[model samples]
Target: MSSSSKIRVIVVDDSALVRSLLAEIINRQPDMQCIGTANDPLVAREMIREMNPDVITLDVEMPRMDGIDFLGRLMRLRPMPVVMISTLTERGAEVTMRALELGAVDFVAKPRVGLASGLNELAAQIVDKIRVAAVAQVRRAPAASAGAIVHPHAGGAAAAAPVAASPLLGRLSTEKLVAIGASTGGTEAIREVLVHLPADAPAIVITQHMPPGFTTSFAARLNSLCQITVKEAVQGERILPGHAYIAPGGRQFALAKSGANYVAVVDDGPPVNRHKPSVEVLFKSVAAHVGRNAVGIMLTGMGADGAAAMREMKDAGSYNYVQDEASCIVFGMPREAIAHGAADEVLPLAQIAPALVARLRGAGDRVHHRI
Candidate 1:
């Protein structure tokens, strides 16, 4: 964060042009410097030994050794933050998710075409991701294996039980909605929260900053791991209990009440706070439509995208929770919500899912009381 301590970065890609352009963008930052570039894993392995960079930008696919394999080895051997540069395709998104599971800090999608022109459009994003990566905590691979990585927020098996009785679980409980917003490190954060939820939890909605072609895979990934169904939001679909809808990337998703039931409304809109599926947009919609019947959650991210709207939700009588700084990969979103007096409670990641269950079960009024 200081001027003297620059964020040392390394760019690893097979393309000469990409390496050069990435180096240029990284060097342009006042607080960052690209110390080295490598065309393949072999070269990167040797360069890493000498440079010892604070962060790495890796291409998703490479000759000889793919990015996923190399990332696994790197995290196992010498844990450090890594940001993946992946193609904008379904395959790329799936691979990027694997990289995250292998300890990647984040990822940026490569332009579909026009390499030079697209890279120019992504200059700010590339630099910002690098800065965030530099500050991220890179955990070493688990002792069991590199593939055994689990999110820090995931709770044990007991978290899967449904609350027997509660104020929100009566005949009127279907009207309740749980709205969640996250970015940066949110994919895993959301997964951690979702996997612990019971199959009968209230309807949940999520907005995680991501590019086109990624949200479907993300939703599928969660659906496979969680007890509840998870799917990408479709316009006009009725919101139902035990299901989680993820906002499609590159579009705005909002909640709209149709008489007694709520439905997802998806539309093309200009980016809000520089994100298409901005957390602010979703939170604002929930505050307006669901009011006190909603529960707002602000999770790990790199920006204050949802802080003001979260406050609006709180002012409308809805209780809200934020992930605490110590458990977050980056504490920007939750920290901002806390600063704005938007959060009712700041909880560790491992406690948030269970706390939500307790609140909906009517026990939260006595336990995990609002600060």
Candidate 2:
């Protein structure tokens, strides 16, 4: 590719080896070119000003400033797509989530120190994320004063009647369950959607691309923060209302009907979409077991892993939704589903939860009134 066509990137890390390795991997890509490397946030700031790169790969732990602090400053000052490099630990995951909320695009788990064991895996993920980060839309945070808040019923008694029944006020039903699948940038994206759901939101089953030991902690953390219950799924466990279950990493989780209730069936299966806990696997199971009763959602992620399976559910008369391209860190999966005519609706992150509730309650007509 020509210089103008190449995706220019800046690599920021304290480690010289990591910097070199990342630069080498990025340069090897036909569409990517490394513009510069920075050892810390101070240098990174100057490099960003001088190089004006399209994307940045930043290390979470740095000498002068931590990645999270730098990310906040960067977002407020100069917004650009940033992919965080973090260690594979509970603390790292927590910090990574914070970075995403601060405006970083995505994250890649750094390899553990062991020759031949960790480096190979880390290299693959780093390269994949860099490619996706290049195409991601990086937007600056909106100014706090941009919008005016209209006080409900503050105008007069007549205004109070309509205000009392705002369109946004809708009840959530627990009789229906939602099954979601996502990968790459999913950790933060899923959190954004789940956090906004009401306490009585439909039961949720999530199959995110993750490894063993991570899902448990991720679920626990989400449970603590959200009103609805959240936990990692176990084999033969019945799905319940007002709770969310995350499929354990490294195992395929499928939904099976047991009389009147649904149960999660965990099994060691071959990797689909190059992922053991594949979204396709879970969505397919949901399509077969729940049919029209399930609401299937495919979120932001790389590859078309869940698109086909989401289509299967749509064909079975289930309500299906995909994240719109503008809000996605990577639009691959959702785009695929939308292109295949599988999604009943393509919604932004903010609209998904509310739309979900409306669909479950057979209130689509009322929901369409707002659109």
Local distance difference test values of all predictions, in order? 0.86, 0.76
Q: Which segments of candidate 2 are over 4 A away from where they belong?
A: 115-117, 142-175, 363-371
What's the TM-score of each model vs. the native?
A: 0.91, 0.84
Tens digit per residue, CA lDDT, model 1, 17-80 = 9999999988888889889999999999999999888999999999999989899888878889
- Candidate 2 lDDT over residue span 137-184, tens digit each: 676643223222211111111111111112322432434678898876
Question: Which lDDT value does model 2 have at 216?
Answer: 74
Determine which window of 10 residues in candidate 2 has minimal summed lDDT.
152-161
User: How does candidate 2 fare on TM-score?
Assistant: 0.84
Model 1 worst lDDT run, 10 consecutive residues: 152-161
lDDT of 1 at 276: 93
Estimate candidate 2's alpha-carbon lDDT, on a 0 to 1 scale.
0.76
Clashing pairs for predicted structure model 2, backbone only: none
Best by TM-score: 1
**Global lDDT of model 1:** 0.86
For candidate 2, the per-residue lDDT at 321 reads: 83
